[model samples]
Target: MKKKLIFLTNIFLCILFIRFVSAAGTAGSLNINIIESQCLLDFGEGWNFFSFCRNLIDKNASNVFSSAENNYRYIMRWNQEKQEFDIFSPRSSRNPVPDLNDDESYFIYFYSNSYLDVNGTSPGDESRNLVEGWNAPSYQLGFSKTIDSLTLPIEYQYRYIMKWNLSRQEFDIFSQKSLKNPFGTIDQEEGFFIYSKEDLILNIFNMQ
Candidate 1:
């Protein structure tokens, strides 16, 4: 009788251990969906500066621009390290720009007005590192936000902000110290150039 009671106690302990392990596994393996949203981009004739706010499943430039293949002339990306433009033409055999990233911006020249529809995942808690000098970064938010709404990292300063004017083909400038600032709000799918005084990690959008 004593031996049987010991055996029953051991069995109960074993079951408890198994249940504990199962609970631990479930807690450790929590799945979070990152790509939970979609973004639609509109492009016009001349130069359209744009960026993807969400993480794309397929980032290949050719595949992303497949819908507007015949309409666009070329796609250009800024080389921050080299401080030059890397252009990719669909007709060209040797292309410099291959993939399009979420935090980066690109310039596409279209023959006529067209739109790009893409399904992407959310950029949750993602931050972009800005180098000292000129950096072309996209606002990775779903809605439109003004330039004043942006918050930079401590000790880092924004010297100026410039947005590409599609019709005038000129830059609309914005500065904090300027008496008259034309550049006001930043829209979705829009890309802009910002000059940073120091190198720091920039939180593009407030998660809250």
Candidate 2:
């Protein structure tokens, strides 16, 4: 009887492990140390449009846009909705930074894949925002791997999606996700520390 019980317990533990692994993400997992995050619409075949923004203001240690963040605005041109408005706050930086091991296990979270809102129009200093953060633009996913030791150079990222409900004037808060892209850019390192093509995002975006 005891042997049978032990066998059942082992089976249960195995099932639990499998469940956890499957819950990770649909995409093949990558070990990325995501120091920052952002959001956009996955337009398919590796083309994604900067869509609505999501800020993980909870990470007190995360990179934040300056108080002078008012000079910018994010506009999302959803094919489904007409009256477009600001997607998120420049103050609400979309890089969704999450917690990971102190070492080789940092991970990111992606909420959804559809519905895009382009990066905001900030006319000043887009370069400084590039370094202080890592690059996973939109989720709260946890670690990417398990570290047997204390700390090792870590790399991981996670992101999610957001959409608007046409019926609701206010953003959907989290609904329709329509786009898909195997290739996209990561702005996790922008607007925080390293400075380069500061407004590269705005310059590249051709929104009408």
Candidate 3:
């Protein structure tokens, strides 16, 4: 009877161990889903090095280069002057400056890995912080506010805000000096190069 009891205890322990292993494997696989998910990038805070995808340009290199984690790539940046993309790859001899302006939102691609997981990510912010310099910032026009409806100080009225037409790919001057129609509406997706007289924060709340 004692021998029978020992055999039964051993069987129970073996079953428990198998179940624990199975659960652990399932959890590991779930991490792959997080890596494959899409995340938005906001340039409101500032420009910095970003790893938008899970595959690194150099597969054998250490994960220290990628802030996102192991098996991730640094992706590419845009050249505003050249209107071209500066991509990072092992084959490229010269690497261009990786910087993105607030003028537009970009879509990033990634290589999927079934073995990795992403713990958390920040998509950036809708609002932007500006210093006492030229800032090319874009914000979604909220509530269809007309140019005239927007209020600014009398001193900063003329030439403070420059509106961009995405379709034309050019900026149309709008200021008190130009005497442009204040009733004209600005698109939210369009970028506005604002010349800040002082340090201030620009927030675009009503963006879809």
Candidate 4:
């Protein structure tokens, strides 16, 4: 009778382990039904490297994007200047906008203006320069599931004002990393939207 009980307990544990693994697999899957999907704004074959961003005020690039992961590569390329994008990831101010519009959901970038980023990522003051000629980039500004379920940036100078769509599940940026003093000095401007003006954590927006 004791032997029978032990056998049943082992069987139950085995079944529970199987179910737990299956559930985790389901949660880790990436949903393909994005807000918008386009093949026209291709990333082009192989790896592509860019070098600068046009001023946002030059034109409005809201509502025009490809995907959210790699915003710079999926913009509508016209005249080779590339136009129409949502997010901006600052890479040394070189290729700041990445594309006219960013199709990706997450990244680091240079914003046109801190206040203007709330204007639907339109053409505006775009970048993360603390001082003139100090075009220091706001890197590590994208998403990372490898750390946890879904995590936002873990850097102070990497803020991007995002218009999040819960139902559609998207983050369309209007303004990105722009500040009077990204170096955390008293000379900083009025402060970014919900940001603490203070360097709270290395990585904010861990998705609640």
Candidate 5:
């Protein structure tokens, strides 16, 4: 009788341990699926500097801008090699910009307050190649981070970082060597310009 009672107790404890492990695994999977589902961004009237923090199912400019078709005026992307703005207007018959890339950023003009709701997969371990001059790159994370917290290679050097001021219609600049910097944090919904002294890859890990 004593041996049988001991055996029964051991089996009960083993079953509880297995059930706990299964529950924990299911919770983790649910969290990952929720994080990768969609990204929501808000845009005010006039020019707004923006970028998508996820990889959309359709990257075409038309499909991505479908939500704000009536409110948006145009979307302009900076041409790094040509040193000009590639404009894409819904009203125009011929648009210079066709596709919206994950690594690049754009300046979008809107007539009224609107928002972009993008359903896409999460961008895992984002990285961008910076040239010797100005580069308009997007922050590919799902959360906000300060400029000082960004990790860069030892050989890479940044001269300045600038973010567009939507209300004031100006650029908020942040310099590493400057005593007074206006822009410090980088928001996930917006994009910013960075000047690099040399060519290097900017790696941003997705901590979400």
Candidate 6:
């Protein structure tokens, strides 16, 4: 009887894992490590963005983007009803709290830098807002995404995709002028800096 119960428990755990991956869809798992300081970041893929924010502000007592008077983080969670990403200041009672959905993601600036040891399996997705200048971003997938897959327009006068090499802990620049293959794959959880010709929206949510 005890052996049968153990077997059933294993089965249940497997189902939960399967559900977690399926829910994340193209964005895949959220596994990241903060080896350095001084950077704004998106919730690693497959995470409930608001819950992660609350965990930092409420549970961990970490400052995300708040003043001493109002301890909290400036997190943006996608509003499906409104079809837009809205800012969330945890200290404010009027803020509409929303879940960071499986097919969406947002960015947060952490002024009070601290080491992060992230480990979990909750479903999520990826999206990045690009302004007409250098912007730091990361891909929250278990695998890499190729440049061809990104469909970057070569006609854009000023463009650059600089991917951070996690293994070497360095930056790799990709541009039309650069002889290095611009069509290489940008690996999972690899933070990058992009210089866009104009304002743009990047959606890796549908990437597979």
Return the lDDT, model 4, position 109.
26
Off by over 4 Å in 2: 1-40, 43-108, 122-125, 129-208
Q: Which segments of candidate 5 are over 4 A away from where they belong?
A: 1-36, 154-156
Cα lDDT computed for each candidate against the true fold: 0.71, 0.22, 0.37, 0.24, 0.73, 0.43
* Lowest lDDT block of 10, candidate 5: 1-10
- After superposition, candidate 3 runs with Cα above 4 Å error: 1-125, 140-144, 148-158, 166-169
lDDT of 3 at 134: 52
TM-score of each: 0.78, 0.16, 0.37, 0.15, 0.79, 0.42
Error of 2 at 179 (Å): 36
Q: In terms of TM-score, which candidate is strongest?
A: 5
Please report, as a residue range, the 10-residue window in candidate 6 with the lowest summed lDDT: 1-10
Off by over 4 Å in 1: 1-36, 152-156, 206-208
Order the candidates by TM-score, highest first — what do you get?
5, 1, 6, 3, 2, 4
The residue-level lDDT of candidate 3 at 56 comes to 22
> In angstroms, what RMSD does candidate 2 have relative to the true structure?
22.9
Q: What is candidate 5's lDDT per residue for 59-129, written digit by digit as tens?
A: 88988989789888889998877767899999887888878888888899989877677766666777888
Instruction: Name the lDDT value of residue 141 in candidate 5.
Output: 71
Best by lDDT: 5
Give the per-residue Cα lDDT of candidate 4 at 92. Answer: 32
**Model 3 lDDT tens row, 1-208:** 0000011111112212222336446532221122222223222111222222211223322232344333334444443335455665433445453333333332223343212221222223345555665555444332243554433332462246665332243455655556554325544233445556666665544433
**What would the per-residue lDDT of candidate 4 be over residues 1-208, giving only the tens digit for each residue?**
0000011111112212222337446533332321211111112232222211112222333323322323333221222113223434222344344444321222222112111111121112222312211111221111222212111343344344323222233433322344332222101011111222333332322221
Candidate 1 residue-wise lDDT, 60-134, digit = tens: 989988998999998889887787899999998889888887888888899998867665665656577778888
Please report how far candidate 5 places residue 113 from its true position, in Å: 0.3
Model 2, span 1-208: residue lDDT tens: 0000011111112212122235656544344332233333222222122211323333222222222233223322221112122233233556222221111111111222222222222122111111122221221111111111101111121122222222231222211132543212222211111112222221122111
Q: Give the TM-score (vs. native) of candidate 3.
A: 0.37
Q: Let me know the TM-score candidate 5 reaches against the reference structure.
A: 0.79
| Best of the two (1, 3) by TM-score | 1
Question: Model 5 clash pairs?
Answer: none
